[model samples]
Target: MKQRLLLATLICLPLSVLAQDSGTQSVDNEALTVYGRANVSLQSSDEGDGSYSDLESNSSRFGLKGKGQLKDQLEVFYQIEFGIDLADFDEGDDAVSNRNQVVGLRGSFGEVMLGRYDTFLKDSQGSVDAFTDYEADLKSLFRGENRPDNTVTYYSPSFNHFKVGGTFIASGDETGDDGISVGIIYGDKKLKKTPFYAALAIDRDVADYDIEQVTVATKLGATIVGAALQQFERTDGLYNSDGYLLSASHPVKQWVFKAQYQAVKYDSDKDASISVGADYFFNADTRVYAWYTGRECDIQLYQSRGCGASNGVEQDFLAVGIRHDFSW
Candidate 1:
């Protein structure tokens, strides 16, 4: 408890005190900035042969971030973010501990990040995930989001609406595992009518089966849209796994409507999944969302799971939730 109190005080500390000890600007516009969101939701589900409805008691929490200019061309950044499982906050670790942490550096050439950080491809499309993240939502840019063990990522500077990023991943186990990925992004932030932007990336890794993925995104005037296509090749499996996503968002002042489509297929044996989701923003810091998905894993309905294939088994699911963000 004492430790938590100290950490909280430290985050709220004034810049004057920080400058007195460092003699440099400790906080700028987004420097020393903090951001995060909270979430609450319910679910109506069908597990192949059974159906049930449940009100989720726990949701998501918020986060805080701090950025420091280390030099004219160099900067340091850190983010302390976590989730609140309202369903069981007091049952396990404290609510504040379930967070995303990172400490990295930025410069004129590029940016290098360490600690609990997301992958290059995930970061590139994170901007589009602003509205969705759930089992049935393919628009979920980071399929599985988190700081996976030890990650070192490099982000290239943007030029001609194009940028590149790469990363090296370490196996958290003593076996000392290692893998890497490369990605390229292109887009225009300014659109004459709808105001649109887009980015595409291809990525791979040795862990969790070698994967080849491409993510694309574009935002229109009052509407934001994105799409992703990926292939997951299991080393020991007979067929590969493939999936694609399409999502769009419409804005009405502080209120926004969002939706996504997801489809996944595996192997020649057969299995597929499709999902759709929606979001309504009450404000920048708060929003409500819901999604429905259906999937089937029948091993007797396909020739292969390369690009286009479908199976006959079906499983249905639904998720509904809300989020709130607050930082100081």
Candidate 2:
């Protein structure tokens, strides 16, 4: 707790100093901008034994960002993002500029950034995750959704619909563990008729864990479909796991209907989940949505024993919410 507080203070101190130095002239209005998304929901969940409900602030966040040309072919950029926990008001409930805080250089060759940021393995998944920031999020059962601190990243220029990126993490504070992540993505959004996108990614934590993943998506007119597969391996060759996700969406006018299924098989356990949802777009930056997700998992109580039938559990969730995005 002390460490987090100190870090937050450090992050904010510099911005405060910059804000006060020149007052109104501190930032270039033409290059600097503020952007954010606010997502909130009323949620109900069933755990087989009982049911419960609450209001949730699903990863609502805001950020300040800017970029400017540095020379003939180079540019410099910076961003600081924070998470707001509207549903929780306790001390430390809000993250002080915790998301995608980075400074980078972009040029004709590509881009290089250093800061606390998401790994390429996490970023490459893209919108294939139909139920992100919710109870049915892909991170619940899969491993590669990481945003580690003290990292350096490089992205290659796109060529023929292909782009590549890599991330390297500095030594861990206590354990001195180092990490690396790499990913490649292809294709772009097809707005007219049929279009496709695909990505492959791998992440490695020295002597700790390794993950490989692939994601693909395609659009056909008003319908879109996507899938993802991920595999995890531990250094000790124990507790290996794998998972897959499938999703589809159809749009009719201003409304979209979506559904998804995901499954994971671990060395000693197995789990599966399904979700269905719909969204009504009020505009490009605003929408209301509702979704339901159901999950079941079975576990083995003892390593030497068979799976326990009683160790299985089921859960379900229903939620309705509005999401809004804005920039200025």
Candidate 3:
């Protein structure tokens, strides 16, 4: 009698578990999102002779992104983005600028996107650089940082804090060369307390350009630090250049303090820049910033040491602006 009762109890347990699981299943809601950021700033820069000021729109954009559920392990997604210039009202037909526009499939394996978008080399840098759209942006001293049209990209699923991505560009340009870019990144952004990210990337044959870059960033409590190094080679190794950057930021309450230093060298011409800035956030979608940047460059005749010292020119940049972003 005891064995029969025990067997009956086990038979009922499976049904009870199944009922609980069915009750917890979530209802799917198919939704599309509209997102955008409107950023404008009053900026001024001095180049030894005098200071110049201008009202500018810094990467203001609008975009639509959506994903549809297909199966348990796969989905379809697409995004279309356009840049707007708030400072220019009479630009006529060139007013609307094209940004990232892509459609792709995502699955347990990874993702594949095809359209106009940024290269894997540029995406590998992520949010490492504190100053992106400002005067001291990394692109000011680096090469091959771009978003191109007619591109295909792939990203691998992360495993053990490691992931890889690649991009191919089929742009019909004067160089008559196809572009290839690839990168590998480590560490997950969800980590807390001591999260770290590192990446290495290479780009070739994009408008007769070839470049290799390495970037790393880490967060320790409230402090973030990042660094990057790049080598540029072109014309079958006949020309070569290199650049490096170092940056750090600390956040306190609603404010963030940031600083960066960068240097680039090509032949005998060398340029170096340093910038310091602060930002105040009103909320998650709005903020104000002030920054100061200074640069010095020298042109040499024979790639000799200490050349063009007297011919060097110094420049300075200062800006204060507000940025707002919205999404639905």
Candidate 4:
């Protein structure tokens, strides 16, 4: 009950402030925007056993974002985003989870944000993952994909198509080791105005692993191709792993076709996955999509990482869904 109240307060407080200020200021310089997306799918899944049908909610979320002028060339910004599960309305904390809730300042020096958010290494991936938030998300085969609390991040202003950023994760009193992440990126992640994008990032002691990753994507005509390679080492020096991803997508009018391949190897254990999907757009804000992904995993990987199945088992998923995004 207390958690619910706290969350409600956090959400409503900003709106109340916006209401009081909007009447006297320009909406463009000081305004609050409510935005979110709903993404749900029906899936036929097999986890190395029998097949079953289920409905899945793919990280659907809603939030409020606002920015206010603070001075001559400075601004204060904030966002309160939360994840909602639409497939099953279970009670308790699982019903709603935090996403990128943060408060920050931006100016000529760039931006500095505080609170819970994705690390620099994680953000460096950008939109290269063709199957993000789905069964084939890069998090399934790679380390350093972290969104941790008690974080402080800084992003430098773009200089000649290049930018750099860093994140510091405070371990609090419970843990003595602090985590750090850093990244350098070039070009635009959306590829809307740029022909190519590239990023190199590193994480140390975040989520109990050290990781180095490189990601690149290029737009050729109407097609986009992306790839990523990563190396992960356990902070305790007990294990080391490597992974790579290749993905491509092509759009024809209102239809898009996508495919991806990814694999990870650790010692003698290996896991690999393949996925194919397509999307049909009703408009810019809505789309319907379907995808199929299959994976083969080694037992050793299951024991050590709690991923995949024992004895080189295979798992598969086929899903179709609709997504609608809205902003106000």
Candidate 5:
């Protein structure tokens, strides 16, 4: 009787363990994820007036991103991030971090995000950059979307050949302007070519001013290019506008030869300007770049208080720099 009781106990134990695991399977596989990145480099800048040199810390940073499945039809997700700038050299404390937070949800319709995050155009700019980070050849010059504070965003699933996204900025709690931006990116899988992109953005203040930006970008092999034309208007009759950039790259083993040209036309009769540059890449994440930029600005006669059309002058700039990317 004792041996039979022990055998039955062992059999029941296995059945009990199976029942517990079956009930907890869903809990063990709960939806969640984590990811991050980091980077650093050396750079130099020459604006024709002077040359500045320093080792710049790229977006050496990290963060947590994940989602939780509440049911078959509903789920929630979020991301919080920050940068680490090693350029300071002093590692003790004086570090600064900026606009790197994101939160959102996915549903049957689409995904809606709210937090301090990059606007859509931000990623588009990086697509064409030799170095798509702080150490990048033209990062400051590009001024892509990057991250913004108190922003709301939405991303939609692809419809045939297009994937679309939009973002709204302006918590009104800060000095920033209220803006809405939208973009459409088209993929051509059949052609085996890079996708094409187009975007329109508008920003305004209820009683003060307004502005608009329209952009287009595309890439072919080692060449990536983009353009953004923007118009700014204010109640005081102040109008301003400008746009330009052309680029190409050829990769040979570990090195790349790149060329770029840019032009700018100003509303103030600043005469059109043109720029050209070249770079050699050591790798996909790093490169050394140099540029020659020239600009012609109009002069105003002190006596006539009007434009002196012929007084246009030109300034030349020679620039050299290195770029790198980081992810942690």
Candidate 6:
């Protein structure tokens, strides 16, 4: 707790100093943005044992971020984000979780950040995971999805739609060795103005595993198709696995249809999951959606234990939800 508090102070102190020094300038010279998303769902889940219903909070979060211009074309920026659990608010510490909180600088040399944030290997997936934050999130099958503290990261500006990034994670007296994550990305993940997106990333000793991942997505007429391949190896060499993900989505007017499939293979043990869903947009900021996910595994693969099942059992989930996003 003390360490976290100190890290927060360190991140905020420089920003405060910069704000005061820039006081002489117009307020418009600096922008403070408040952004958030509220996503909740009602779910009917079955884990090969029994079926139950509950409300779930799907990675809902709020954050504040801003940037202040400095001399030599450099700028200072910071962000503090926290996840909120709307379904069970009284869960104590679990109710509120830390997310990508960081202080950084950007200029001609590109950008550098310090604090707690997602590693480059994790960010390389982009928006390919159509079922992100859901029961079938890709993090369940892949090993590189990590957000660690005591870290420094760097990104180079895009050149011809290509950019490179890396993260250095400090062990902080916990281990004698540190970790690193690096990636090279091309094109936009949103596929807005870009026709395709691709990324290759690798992680060493992050989250107890070494990983190599490649992700690609492209628009085919009105539909978007995406895929990801990953290789995971434990640092201790006790385990190794390979996985792949395939996803697609299509939009018709205000409604969008989506589907995803993921599988992992390891030493004769296999895990797989499938999800299909649709979203109806009230506008760009609000939407209602429904999805069904089914997962089966030969061994425990994630914290949720492969759809909340034990070993060889199959688990299933059906969810309907609403999401609202706001920014200022």
lDDT of residue 33 for candidate 6: 98
Model 3: runs farther than 4 Å from truth? 1-29, 89-93, 173-175, 189-194, 236-238, 299-311
What pairs collide in candidate 3? none
Q: Which residue runs of candidate 1 sit more than 4 Å off their true CA positions?
A: 1-34, 57-59, 89-99, 127-131, 139-146, 172-176, 188-202, 219-221, 235-239, 252-255, 267-278, 299-313
Instruction: Summing lDDT over every window of 10 consecutive residues in candidate 2, give the lowest-scoring window.
Output: 301-310
Determine which window of 10 residues in candidate 4 has minimal summed lDDT.
1-10
* Whole-model lDDT values for every prediction: 0.56, 0.77, 0.78, 0.84, 0.51, 0.85
149-184: candidate 6 lDDT, tens digit per residue: 978777878999999888888788865457888889
lDDT of 1 at 269: 40
- Steric collisions counted per model: 13, 0, 0, 0, 9, 0
Cα lDDT tens digits, model 5, 67-181, are: 7764454456787776766566575764657546876656554566777877665543433444344322343222233466757776666676566666666546556445554
Among these predictions, the greatest lDDT belongs to 6
* Candidate 1 CA-lDDT value: 0.56
lDDT-better candidate, 3 vs 5: 3
- Displacement of the residue 101 alpha carbon in candidate 3, Å: 0.2
Q: How many times do residue backbones clash in model 5? A: 9
lDDT of 4 by residue, 236-265 (tens): 887788889999999999999999999888
TM-scores of all models?
A: 0.72, 0.84, 0.84, 0.89, 0.63, 0.89
lDDT of 2 by residue, 5-82 (tens): 433433443344344435232222236899998999999977667898988889899999988754545667888988
Better of 3 and 6 by TM-score: 6
User: How would you encode candidate 1's per-residue C-alpha lDDT over 1-328 as one tens digit per residue?
Assistant: 3323422332333222334345545544354655655556677766555778765544365677877766466667877767655654555566555445677666665666666666665555544543344554332222323346566666767887677776667666666445555567776433332344555554444444455666555656567777667776544465466766676767776655666655555444434455556567776667777777666555453332211233344567677777677766
Which of the two, 2 or 3, has more lDDT? 3
